[model samples]
Target: MKRIAIIGAGASGLTAACYASGDGRHVLLFEKQKKIGRKLLVTGNGRCNISNRNIIAGHYHGHNSRFVDAVFSRFSLQDTITFFEELGVPFIEEDEGRLYPASLQASTITKVFQYELKKRNVDLQLHRRIERIEYEETGFTLYTAGAEEHRVDSVILAAGSCAFPPAGASNIGYDLARSLGHRVYEPWPVILPVTIPLKSLHQLQGIKWDAAIRVEVNGKEQERSVGELLFTAYGISGPVSLNVSRSVNAAVIAGKSPVVIIDLYPSMSGDDLARRLDRLWSDGGKKTGFSLLGIMKERMPEVLCGIAGVDPEKRVASLTPADKEKIAGTMKNLILEPGKPRGFQEAVAAAGGVDVDEIDPATMESKLVRNLYITGELLDVDGDSGGYNLQFAWSTGAIAGMAQ
Candidate 1:
C-alpha cells in the first residue's frame, strides 16, 4: 500500500483523509494541535456551517478566481452533501441556504469524521507538526518537530491559513508552499469588524439595526452589503459590516481611506423616508424632535437630530422644512470612515494565499511538484460569508483527495 501523508487535519485535511484512505493507500493525518478540527469546531459560532446550497464561482475572490470553477465542477455541492449524509451527518438548511448538520453542533461533524477515520484505520497523528518536507524522485520525506521524519508516496498540504490563531492557525502552509517554489500572495484578514473610531458612533455602542452598508474608497463605490449592522466601542460589526469588511480592509491596506455609508432604512427610498418623517412630524402633538422619531432606538434619535442640526428637545412642530430635509438626508446616508479591520484573531477567513495559477484546479496538485496537492484556504481563493468559504474548502479537499 502507498503511504499518503496529509498535513493540518483541518476541514480540508480531514475531508481529504476520509476520501484518500482505504483505496490500497495508507493515509497519515497530522495535526499540530492536540485535538483534530479545532478550527472546524468553532466555525459558524460552533454550528459548523458545512456548505452553502447556492454555490457559485462569483461568490469567491482571488487573483484568478476562475480557478475554483474546475474544482467545483469535479466535486459539486451535491457531492459534498451526499458524502456527509453517507457519513451519518445529514444537513439542515438555514437562512441564505447555509447548511448545518442536523444536530446543529460542530462537534457532531468532528465526531462523525473521527469515527469514520478510525473505522478506516487511518493513522491520525495529533500534536505532530510537520516542520518541513523533503521531496525526491523516489517519494517524499516529511520532517516533524524534533527532526522526526517519515516517508510517504504522496503529500497533501491542507493546512489552513492564519485566520484564527487561537485554533492553531499559522503561516506554515504558506511557508511550505513557498519552499516548494509557489508564489504566495500576502494574506490579510477578512470577514471581521471595522474600526470606525468616531466618538459620535461610539455612544451608540451595543445598538443593532438592520441596515445597508456600502464601502466607498476615494469617493468611488466598491461594494455593498445589506443585513444587521451592529455598533461597537471600536467601530461597526454584525453581518452587514462583516460582509463589507473585505473591501474596507483592502482599501486601508492600499493606504486609501474607506468610508462606510449606512442606509438606516434600506427598504425605503429617500422620498419614502422624507415622507415618513413628514407624517411623524405632522402627527406629533407636543413631542420633542427626539420623541417624534420614536421609530429609532433610544439615544439614536439624539445623534441623528444632532447631525441634522436640530435640537432633540425642540418641538417637532417647530422644525422647519430645511431641518426636516437635513434629518432625512442624514438618515438615508450615514457616512462613517473606518480605520482598519480587526486582525486575524477575529477574522473568519483570510483573503490571500498561494497563487491559484500555480495549482491545477482540476486536481488541486501543484504544477511545480508532482503528487503534491494543495487544498482549502491555503489556495488564493476565498469566498464571501454565509457558508461559501466552507463550500470551497469541501470542493478543493474532495478534488485533491480523489486525484490520482
Candidate 2:
C-alpha cells in the first residue's frame, strides 16, 4: 500500500485520514495540538455545526471559484449527511440550513472522526508540529519540530488558517506552499466583527437586538444578513456582522468605503410602518416620545426614539407629518459606518490561502511538486457562516485523499 502524510488533524486533516486510510493506504496524520479538534470544540460554541443542509460553493471566495465549484459538486451536502449518518452521527437542520448533530455536542462530532481513524488504523500523531517538507524526485521528506524525519509517497497539506489561534492554528502550511514553488495568496481575516464609528460607539453600546443588516460599499450592496446584532465596546458583532464581513473585506481591499444599514424592523415596510406609527400616535397622543415607542422594540424604545427623529421631551400629539416621514425612513434605514475589521486572530476563518492556481483543484495536488496535495483552509476557498466552511474542508480533503 502507498503511504500518505497528512499534516494538521483539524476537521480537514482527520477527514482526509479517514478517507485515505479507507482506501487501504497507509495514512499518517500530524496534529500540532496536544489533542485534535480543539477548534472544533469551540465551533458553534461547542454545538459542532458540522455542515449546513444548504451547501453552496458560490458563497466561497477564491481567485478561481470554478475550482471550488467542481470539488463541492463531488462531495455535496447530501453526501455529507449520508457520510455522517453512516458514522452514527445523525444531524438536525436548524433554520437557515445550519446542521448540527442530533446530540448537539461537538465532542460527538469529533468522536466520530476519531472512531473512523481508529477503525482504519490510521496513524494519528498528536503534539506533532510539522516544520518543513522537502520534495524529492519520487516522494517527499517531512521534518518535524520533534527532531524526527519521515518520508512519504504523497502529502496532503490540510493545516488550517490562522483563525482561532487558541486552537493551535499555525503557519506551517503557508510556508510549505511558498517554499515548494507555489504562489501563496496573502491571507486576510474574514467572518469577523466590524469596527464601529465614534458616533455608533457613543450612541450604541451594550445594545443587543435581532435585526436585518446589509452592508454597502461605494453605493453598491455587498452583503445582507438578518440575525442578532450585538454591540461591543469596540464595535458590532453577532451573526449578521460576521456574515456580512466577507463582503466588507472584499470591498475594503478593493478600496471601497463601507457602510452598513440596519433595518431595525425588517418585517415592516415604510408605508406599513408609517401607518402603524400613525395609529400608535393617534392612540397615545398624550404619551411622551419614550412612552409611544413601547409598541415596537421594547428593548430600546429610547434609542428607537432617536432613530425615528422624535424628540424625547415632545408629546406624541406635537409630531408633524414630516416627523412621521423621518421616523419611517430612519426605522428602515439606520445608517452606520463600518470601519476596518478586527484581525484574523478573532475571525471565524480567514480568506486567501494557498493559491488555487498553484494546486490542481480536481485532486488538490500541488501543481509544482509531485506527490503533494493541499486541502482545508490552506486552500484559498472560504464560505459563509452556516456550516459551509466545514463542508469545504470535508470535500477538499476527500478529493485529496482519493487522489493519494
Candidate 3:
C-alpha cells in the first residue's frame, strides 16, 4: 500500500488527512503542537465560523487569482456544507453569510474532524515538529526535530503560517517548501489591530460605534470597510478595523505608511451633519458645544470637540458657521497616522507564504517537487476576517487530498 504523510493537524491539514486516508493509504498526520486544532478552537471567538454561505474568487487575495479560482471550481462552498453535514455537523448562517456551527462551539468542528480522522484510521502524531523534508526518486522523507523520521510515497505540507505563535502557528511549511527548492513570499501579520499615533486616544478606550473606515497608503486610498469601529489604548479594533487590516499590512510591507480615516456618522453626509448641528444649536442655544453631539457616548462628543478645535464648554449659540463646518469635517473624517500592525501574536492570519506560482493550482502539488502537496494558510492566499479563509482551507485541502 502507498503511504502518505500530512504535516500539521489544523483545519486544512485535518481535512486533507480525512480525504487522503479514505482509500486505506497508510496516512500519518504530524502536529507540532501537543494537540490538534488549537488555533481552530479560537476561530470566531470560539463559535467556530465553519464556512461562508456565499464564497467567490473575489473574496480571496494572493499573488495569483487563478489558483483560488481553480480550487473553488472543484470543491465549492456547497460541497463544504455537504461534507460537514455528512459528518453530522450542522450550520447556521448569520448576517453577511457567516456560517457558525449549530451548537455555536468551535470545539464541535474540531471534534468532528477528530472523529472523522479516527474513523478513517489515520495515524495522528502530535508534538512531532518536522525539522527537514527531503525528496528522492521514489518519494519523500521527513525528519522531526526530535530525531524521529518517516518515509512516505507522498507528502502533504499543511503546517500553516506563523501568525499566532503562542497558539502554535509555525513556519515549518515555508521552511520545508524553501528547502525543497520552492520560493516563499515573506509572511507578515494580517487581520490584526493597528497602532495609531494618537497617544491621547486612550482616553476614548472602550468606545465603539458603527463607522466607515478607509485606509490610505502613499496618499492613495486603498480599501474601505464599513462596520463596527472600536477604540483602544493601542489604536483601533473591531470588524471594520480587522477587515481593512490586510490592506494596511500589505501597504506597510511595501514600505509605505497607511493613514486610517474613520467616518463616525456613515449614514449622514457632511452638509447633512452640519445642518443637524445647526438645528441642535437653534433648539439648545445654551447647551455646551460638547452637548450638541451628545447622541453618542458622553466621552465621544468631548473628544470630537477637542479634535475639531471647538471649545467643549462654549455655548452652542456662540458657535460660528466655520465652527460647525469644522466639527462636521472632523466627524466625517477622523484621520489618524498608523504605526506597525500588532504583529503575529495579535494577528488573525498571515498575509504571505509559499508562493502560489510554485504549486499547481488545480492539484496544490508543488511544481518544483513531485508528490509534495501544500494547502491552507501555508499558501500565499488569505481572505477577509469572515469565513472566507476557512473556505480556502477546505477547498485547497480537498483538492490536494484527492491528488494522485
**Predictions in order: lDDT:** 0.88, 0.81, 0.86
lDDT of 3 by residue, 223-267 (tens): 999988889989899889999988887777778878899999999
Which 10 successive residues of model 1 have the least lDDT summed? 284-293
lDDT of 2 by residue, 172-227 (tens): 78998888888888888888888876452545666777889998876878779998
Worst 10 residues of 3 by lDDT: 283-292
How do the predictions measure up, each by TM-score?
0.96, 0.93, 0.96
Better of 1 and 2 by lDDT: 1
Give the residue spans of candidate 3 off by over 4 A. 283-290
Number of the top candidate by lDDT? 1
List the candidate 2 regions with Cα displacement exceeding 4 Å.
Answer: 22-24, 199-207, 283-288, 296-299, 307-310
Per candidate, the number of residue pairs that clash is 0, 0, 0
lDDT of 1 by residue, 195-287 (tens): 987777888899999999998887899999899899998889998898899999999999998899999999999998877877777755555
